[model samples]
Target chain A: MSADRPLEKLRVLVADDSPAMRGIVRAVLSGFGCDRVFEAENGLQALAVTESGGIDLVICDWKMAPCDGIELVRALRDPARSRDPFLPVIMLTAYSETARVREARDAGATEFLAKPFTAETLYQRIAAVINRPRPFVRADGFNGPDRRRLERDHSGAERRQARQS
Target chain B: MSQAKPYEIINPPNKLKAKTGSIPAVNPEAIKRAEEALEQVKSEFRNWLAEEVRKLERAHADIHANGLGGKHGEALFVVAHDLRGLGSTYEFPIVTRLAKSMCKLIETAEKRAAAPRALVDAHVGAIRAALIQNIRSDTDMVGRELVEELERQVIARVGAEG
Candidate 1:
């Protein structure tokens, strides 16, 4: 309830090959009062960690060994392999180009955070995923957020829940 | 890839909100605290940066030994890309700038062979110099000019390729 511990209860997973980066992100998350942070070296490991369940949020690097971020997102979105297809995923990458952003989106990433990222930027991204989650669209070549959202209101929670039913 | 057709939109439950969104207002102190936390470990950042630079050098060595064509060139790109992402975080934004330029120069294996070896070496050298000399950010005028010149050449090379 206090401002200092807003992220205290959140369980976060950071998937990156760089140990330095993992430590930096873990430090920042710890500063935000998030104690349950998980680390994975690549997408495959991230998948293993998530498949075992109990991960609240995911922050993943775009480039990784064997299985990259795109592959991870796709795997997580797949019904057969994923435990929680609706889980929120924040795709972390240095590629800020429109094509790469679109690629991540189409692959089913819930959010995108470009690298050279600041702590504030990372916080805002976490906040964005929490404060606003786009409705998942089941369509051709896309299984994530509705890419064509036009700012129309969702009305209310009950209405959304009813639609899900 | 959605088109003008029938598509189902499912508003998944805001599980994250249920978990940690009761307090809508973000605390600025959270960011300040995170920054301070990073500062507490600032001394170690240089060592971490040096290790990354050495990895970049090894990748560059692979480029020299294998002629920037196969897995070796890809390795160079990976190291440069990681540095481009982590340099600023490790307190060397100038390294980030140089790495970004380097990334643009040899982003793909196809471009690696065509990229001038000297230009690539200059980027690798500048990155190491930034770490060794403690040129952390773009505030250093020489570092800024060096990055700009390298970026210019990379761009011109691409333009010529077109």
Candidate 2:
């Protein structure tokens, strides 16, 4: 995040089934000095944008045909299939249930933002992803950010070896 | 003792920070700009919301013409779900509340078949009323009562217990 225009250089992609919601999200992203915003009507389109390259972050909706947001996240986190396996994703949708949040987190989402969101809320989520990037975790049947509750300095291979051991 | 699940953690390069590390996370000016940007598009909200409402009504109308069994019922759920997400952003938080209650009523197809049509009608009517009456929130008396009743009925219907 920058001082005057934190998201100026950031290229973000918004994926939802609704064109109206996409427009609204674009307007907000534009407000944050994010001139390089992209829109996708569904998860497949979002995948195309991400695969083509240059998208910094993704704000995805949970419901869409052919491929939904959760499916998209799973695809993105698949090391064999994804162009950027560690891409930061913020799941934004109307589903506010604790179960849904857990589902999104388990799908490899970097952060979660429920809809009817204000610019401040959106900004806070984006900032959290950037300012505190999580170390990616790869385990049996799980591939995503480290699911630890606390944040710690993970700057060396020694710490990685210790955790694996 | 059970062995710990073996996992490898990799610290991906923080490109975002590397690109813009000097900037602080909380930028008041940027937030203001974003709010202002939202305001810029506020003019089109009414028409956009009306269109969405029409979609909901059409889906509901389908439920009327055809019974609330399969596609007709699922269609209604889809529109209500979208409204549940869109109402507040469209500047009608009341619509969101009503639509949410509507969603609860028909969250699943099984629930849809069991749900009383009258309850669904109340939610649809309330959403239309919010837009037609220009009621933004439940602060207004009618809005408050309608929401409370709708939520009460939906909770009862869905076994949510309100």
Candidate 3:
């Protein structure tokens, strides 16, 4: 076997309406040593899981009702909430079109994997997203109180500017 | 093309049977809809994980520096609760697995005279990696137009009378 990937035992969310598709994804992920797998039938359920918390990776179908992948990405990237910072999104779908690919990017997807994907493709994409960590700062501010104060002051100034406008 | 016959009939599969069918080509629209819904879940999950990681880190900091009251522990608790729910809903065993681990870590730490910050930090790192992988999975999946069409239909039907 190859050098064991550090991501072994990683948690993954598999959201698809089809039990077969979900099973396939789970099996594929487990083949790479992903022992923890999650499944959701719809976007709303997926959102609940996401919001509920602790997901390491999400492998979602491109199509679902009420909320689709694109809309989900848009919601997650909402500037107002800073919903998920640097969350990598890998879209799984059967729609093979250049325009659609472009749109997925616009929808805030970190990576795109077309349907009928091989195990290699799945592992590779998962590897890429998992390897890169998002940049984050403690709510108290990384630098010190001075830095926190500075940020607060900046926000205050912005608020005043908005009022003036 | 064969001519229509009296014996031939179009028995469209019922909703449950249609959903149960393994072959995706039978209903492109349904597949697309499923894909889009899954996508949305994946995206939201990514963000949620990111935020949880940050919160976990903050909790660690609070324990190390000022100790667990005020905003840090509260945030950690909130994120942990969310993870527990998400894990069960999405069918991701690891999310719940880690969430339970972290939740216990926090709850136990709170009861202790001096919390174990180091162990908590290690768990936080593990959870963070898991969250990142989740996001990557979301982006890697494909099939866009079908999902888009589903989105369009949902929009068109949201206000329609039954």
| Poorly placed runs, candidate 3 (over 4 Å) | A79-83, A132-165, B1-162
DockQ score for model 1, please? 0.46
- Among these predictions, the greatest DockQ belongs to 2
Model 2 lDDT per residue over B33-141, tens place = 9999899889999999999999999999999999889989988998998898999999899998898888888888789889999899888999998999999999999
* iRMS, all models: 4.3, 2.8, 24.1
A40-145: candidate 3 lDDT, tens digit per residue: 8767777777776666667777666567777766665554433443345678765445666767766656667876555556656665554432222222112101
Enumerate the candidates' DockQ scores in order: 0.46, 0.56, 0.01
Pairs of residues at least 3 apart in sequence or in different chains that clash in candidate 1: none
lDDT of 2: 0.87
- For lDDT, the strongest prediction is 2
TM-score of 1: 0.91
Worst 10 residues of 2 chain A by lDDT: A155-164
Off by over 4 Å in 1: A149-165, B1-4, B159-162
- Each model's TM-score? 0.91, 0.92, 0.40
Tens digit per residue, CA lDDT, model 1, A1-165? 457878898899999999988888888888888989999999999999999999999999999998999999999988778999888899988777778888898899988989888888888888888887788877555577766543357553432211233
